[model samples]
Structure formats: C-alpha cells, structure tokens
Target: MLKFVKGYMESIEGVATYPMISLLIFFVFFVILFWWVFTATKEHIKEVSELPLKED
Candidate 1:
C-alpha cells in the first residue's frame, strides 16, 4: 500500500513543492503566533483567561 501510494505521488509533477510550501506556512503561522503571545498585554491575557470562570 505504501509503495503504491508513493509511486502515485512521485508521478505527479510539482508534488514535491507541496510539502515545502506546507512546512513554510506552518512555520510562519507559529512564528506570528509566538510574537503575538509575547507582545500581548498581561492585563488582557488575564482578563481573557478568566472569561470561562466569570459569572455573568
């Protein structure tokens, strides 16, 4: 099964770049998220984190 799937994938043109593009997108998304987490205000983080426990 693995060999058949690998052979089918190898036959497709430009299929190799798909993984690289996916990896690049995955990496960039995390980097942006990391930056956002670090730059966000502590007060805002605390407020948002308590939302679930807060009673309306």
Candidate 2:
C-alpha cells in the first residue's frame, strides 16, 4: 500500500496539468448546477401555470 501511494504521488508530481484538471472539475460542477436550476425553474413555471386564475 505504501508503494502504491508513493507511485501515485510521483505520478501526480510529474504532471503539469493541474489547471486543465481544475477547469474540467469546475465545468462539470457548473453543468450540474445549471441543470438543477433549469429543472427547478420549469417546475415553478408549471405550478404557476396551474394556479386558479383570478377573475378581475
């Protein structure tokens, strides 16, 4: 297990792609958040649409 950890650490140290990995993570998070917001908004619109219309 220690050897595996050491190898993994060495592999991480050899890479200069931290920014790319971080950007990918951020993009994935943003997509999930946007999807959640879209569904919530759609539900709210449907609920509002079903409300009893006030007869002026």
Candidate 3:
C-alpha cells in the first residue's frame, strides 16, 4: 500500500515543492504567533482570559 502511494506521488510533476511551501507557511505562522504572544499586553491578556467567567 505504501509503495503504491509513493509510486503515484512520484509520478506527479513538481510535487516536492508543495511540502517545502507548506512548511515555510507553517514556520512563518508560528514565528509570528510566538512574537505576538511574547509582545502582547498583560492587560489585554487578562481581559481575554477572564472573558469566559464574565456573565452576559
């Protein structure tokens, strides 16, 4: 089953770049998220965190 799937994938043209592009997108997304998480304001974080406990 694995061999068959690999063979099918190997037959496709320009398929290898897809994985690299996907990896780059994910890497960039996480980097930005990490920066945002670190730089976020404490007051904003506290407000957002307490949102669930607040009654409408």
Every model's TM-score: 0.92, 0.45, 0.91
User: Model 1, residue 19: what's the lDDT?
Assistant: 96
Task: List candidate 2 stretches off by more than 4 Å.
Answer: 1-13, 41-56
Best by lDDT: 3
Runs in model 1 deviating more than 4 A are: none
lDDT of 3 by residue, 1-56 (tens): 99999999999999999999999999999999999999999999999999999999
lDDT of 2 by residue, 1-56 (tens): 99998888778864657879999999999999998877787778777777877454
In terms of lDDT, the poorest run of 10 residues in model 3 is: 8-17
Q: Lowest lDDT 10-mer window, candidate 2?
A: 47-56
Candidate 2 achieves a global lDDT of 0.82
- Total clashing residue pairs per candidate? 0, 0, 0
Stretches of candidate 3 above 4 Å error? none
Which residue pairs overlap in candidate 3's backbone? Answer: none
Give the higher-lDDT candidate: 2 or 3: 3
TM-score, cand. 2 vs. native = 0.45
Ranking of all predicted structures according to TM-score, beginning with the best and ending with the worst = 1, 3, 2
Model 1 clashing-pair count = 0
